[model samples]
Target: MMNDVVLKVEGITKTFPGVKALDDVSFDIRSGEVHALVGENGAGKSTLMKVLAGLHTPDGGEINYQGASTHVAGPLDARRKGILLIHQELSLSPELSVAENIYLGAWPTNRFGVLKKRELRRNATRALEALGCGFGPDARVGTLSVAMQQMVEIARAEAFKANVVIFDEPTASLTDTEKDQLFHTIRGLKARGVGIVYISHKMNEIFDITDRITVLRDGQVQGTVETANTDLNQVTRMMIGRTLDTYFIRAKAEFGAEVLRVEELSRSGLFRNVGFSVREGEVLGLYGLVGAGRSEVVETVFGVRKADSGKIYWKGGEIALPRPRQSIDMGMALVPESRKEQGLVLMMGGRENTSLPHLGLFSSVSLMNRPKELAVFEKYRSVLSIKTTGPDQAVSQLSGGNQQKFVLAKWLCADPKLIILDEPTRGIDVGSKSAIHELIADLAEQGLAVIVISSEMPEVLGVSHRVLAMSEGAIVAEFEGDAMTEENLIDAVSHHRGNVAA
Candidate 1:
């Protein structure tokens, strides 16, 4: 077994200024096997991967490559030893062509150092064709969709002749079809004896593709077991140290009168005739595949995008075309999908970011009230359980879950009557997801209307009082009570026949 191991990490312990990222963690990756590295958002999964990829140095431990002790000085050093990491946030050069990006750091050159564009394109095309990628090699990387760009990343890995390849949350941005394609490519790699280290929170994906599962908790190795021998419930227990039954506790809240209603909301090519309503104390779930216009419809309602033809009524009166400021002034809040780019200013301190929406509340005649702002920040920091050294700390320094909490705190401080969250728990860990789901349920119980837009089936089924399925920019079907099964939802989203009354 040791001889079969391509990479071995022994007692890998890495520490930051105030946190022990990876504590005495060890694992072995063998050729032709897919090893899944799983844990909560801050459980040192990324840290350990960085250590293996030479992005970070272990404070204590040893890494043995091919049964020999080794020290990876940097990414280039790791790559020199046939190790490649495909990050969750893709690292492609957007401005460059597909072929150029694939052969970026190691371009083919001539004797006089002139770039060999023809040879580079040829190699890139060969790599893409090997992976069955449909996009042309000369296409601009930025012009391609997220899934296609990911294919380019994989093609680059294959072109490098890497023995060990790590995929970090590869399917986070992909559709069901794209995921299938990715799995097929992974199988091809495995057949050729390329070791894979997959890191993801999606339970179904781990069970489907991974051969072995290694769980980490609190920076320590919890356990490693063959995927065929374990189930989701067991793996979930290992991941968060608890059973699945105890995770999300949904409350059955009685909804009050309709607070917001939309009649035939359309956004031209984006979404069409999308109609829905949210009642006080109700959680309305919008479910669909990628490009189903779920985000677009919500953006229209939130005034980020103007609807082509639609009528929106708040309570009983029809509202005019409300701009973003007007919508916010009318007690509406939207926690957009891309939190870092749209929700929070990463350079600003948590206190400043949290109080951004409510600055007018703490200002008199264009003068900011420091004490009042601090009070608002402190209130949400406590209520949302934001993990930060202080309110003045940069939000970017926090983990994914903590950053999401900070985003929620920012909106909660605004005291909105209706809250629309688009993929609220997209990249967060299981524990943070549980907390957010519970928070949503609690908010609904407290008489706040909530709309949750999510692609995850379990999340939509668990948290929603009513589920609306979207397909091809239209509301295909609506489900409630016993009809809100995953089968029904999938059928509705996949087909365009059923149309339920708004």
Candidate 2:
């Protein structure tokens, strides 16, 4: 069963809009084994998956599924043949219940056309329980958290009894606990001789759950090796075509004046008595679980969420933050968690988004100095190594890595005294993720006080000079120097209780 090739694609090629998404890529998924497909952004990972799922027709290729050469005409047709793709992006209808979403468009009914609601709920519950989902089938998908919604998506796939399951970044938004459950579920599927195509950028997950690792770069197959035979450094080299000598390294910078200090900050129903401070030339990391209220604390500090009882000190002077503009005017910037929603203007080009904070700098008497705007954006574009044909290229047209650079460049243009980056490198590729880490370090080296809020332990440890672990709401432990280990940080957030002065 382990050697049974259930899905095979040979000479697959797909091209679109000046990019060769998949160029004669050949791969196979074996029954009872997890095959990982990994690559950098725009490396054709998604394109290959889309072709397999019938979302895109390949320019040229042949697909053999279960020893039969066939074409998956559409998503329904793929699912009808026991092939299911649990996408990274949740596809469930928010308005529908878990049961409804699981059995959507395929509800059982009597001759009178009445739905078998009881059967649907029972089947949905069975799937959810198999995945150790906490919520019941009757719960509305919209009311659930992103992690829970992800679980529901997987449950929907499992309910259909998929023989070949493709999981693309399935653990992206999941918690440590939920990730464990998903791994267990994947192993259970393998035991039943199901073929799994696991795609993710997280190297640890690929190494842990996958039996074979396939590397793709710029729409071509680099190589595929047994997961046990390959290492992280080798796989990364194949993906980016070079050794990442300093994937995550930052030189120490001397601490300067206090940039921001929070005393007894409390937000009703969100966080409680959250006290922390950041000094210039320091990258302070805030590490916590999904519901640990890390983002809420930063939001409250940045004036987007009002604090119930708190004292904010900027440069040793007490301040009342009534609006974000006031904070911005006073030399503070917050790069939000969701880049698409809150960080940058998608419709606007790189120049426009970069100039949003520097309107005064690039304007004279209500008229924008277009040349100045382009010059400023070009400077940061070079500094951040953002790849784009021109400044007029829309931010939405940029890749995830390039788009994140625009967000950072936009705030960097403000020349803030302090910058708060929330989940800075969530969805970007490793190459871009490494570049952003270096940029964060460079920003700190340039004497800008920075606070990074991240769920990834490696990221927090890699970029921060010191880490403040948050649990529920308050700071549980502070790790610095030799104390800053992933084990200690995880322990602090997972088990440690009671607040320490931050």
Candidate 3:
């Protein structure tokens, strides 16, 4: 049995400042197997992978490769031993061609150190052919789409003759067709006896591709089981230490007067004819597949992007092309999808970040009201259960969930009437997700209109009062009450043709 194991991890423990990321974690990967690593964010999945990739030196652990205990000094050392990691954020030179990126560091050269361009192209083309990638080796990496870049990464991994490959969130930015192509490529690798370690948040992909599943919770190994012998509910339970029912339950809130109305909103080449309304206490869910134009619709409404043709009515009165500041001034707040880049200033302290939108309340012409700022920060920190060393702690040092909480704190301080959250619980732990869901429900209960844009079917179905499904730049279907099932939502987004109830 040990002979079949390609990589083995035992008693792995890694600690960061004030946090133990991984504790006594143990797992194994076998040849010709697609092993899935499923966990909530901050559940030690990435930490453990970093240890294996030579990016992090575990405080305590034993790593055995090919039945022999080995010490991987660095990424180059790991790669030399037939191990390769394909990061979620791809590592490729945008200015270089596909062939150059594939044979990046170790390019083919003659004894005189002259670059062998022909041999480099031939090897890269062979690797691409192995994965059935259609792109030419001469194409510049930057000109390619995200899905095509992912293929190039796979080709590079094969070019290195990697026996064990790790993929982190490989399909997060891919479309349905691109995902199919990736799955086909993975199957081909498995057939060739390469061990695969797949990390993902999407449950459907795990069951579809993995041979076995391992669940991690709070820096510990919950369990590992065969995919054929388990279901999503069971796996989710192991990952979160509770059933999904408790995590999704929300009390109904009565809706009041309409607060937002968009009529025939159109952003050329992005979204078109997108029309929807949210009442004073309604939580409207916007559901769609990747590239279905859900984010574009919300961004247009938030004034982050200009709508070519539409009418935006706030509190029943139509408004013209308002920029982000004007939209914020009009009692609207947007917690963008990319929180790190768009939601918060990472270098600033929590107190400073939370008070950014309402600085006037804590500052005079030439003097800052320190006590008032601290008081406001403390109020939201307690309310949102944000974990931090102090109000002065840098937002960058906080966990993903705490950062999300900080973003919410910033918006809540403005006392907004309408709040828009795009992928609010993305890249966070299950515990934090439940907490945020409850918080959203609480805000709606207090008569604050909310619009949630999400790609997760369970999140949309569980939290929203009504769901609008988008496909190919248009609202194809709407669901409420008894009609808001996952099957109906999937059909609406995938089929791209359905009745619009709105």
The per-prediction tally of clashing pairs is 0, 0, 0
Please give each candidate's TM-score. 0.95, 0.92, 0.91
Off by over 4 Å in 1: 1-3, 497-502
Backbone clashes in candidate 2 total 0
lDDT per residue as tens, model 3, 1-502 = 2138999999999998878899999999999999999887778888888889888898998999988999888777887788888898898999999999988878999999999999999999999888888899999999999999998988977898888899998987776788998999998898888999999877789999999999998799999999999998899889878777777744376999999999999887887788899998899999988878888888888889999998999998998968898998999999999889899999999999998877777899957899999998999999998878798888887768899999999999889999999999886766788889999899999899999998788898888999998987899989999999999998887676434332
Per-residue accuracy of model 2 over 1-502 as CA lDDT, tens digit each:
8999999999999987756789999999998999999988778887888888888999998999989999999888888787888888878899999999988878878899999999998999999988788899999999998878877877766888777889988887777877987898889889989999998878888999999999999889999999999898999999999888887866476899998999989887787888888998999999988878999888888789888898999899998854687888889889999889898889889999999876888999999999888889889999998877688778887777789889999888878989999999887788888888888888888999999988888888988999998887778889899999999987887785444333
Candidate 1 vs 3: which has more TM-score = 1
Candidate 2 differs from the real structure by a C-alpha RMSD in angstroms, to one decimal, of: 2.5
Cα lDDT of candidate 3 equals 0.88
- Tens-digit lDDT track of model 1 for 406-487: 8888888777889999999988877788889999998898888999999898898899999998887888889998999999
Q: TM-score of predicted model 3?
A: 0.91
Displacement of the residue 447 alpha carbon in candidate 2, Å: 1.6
Order of models, best TM-score first: 1, 2, 3
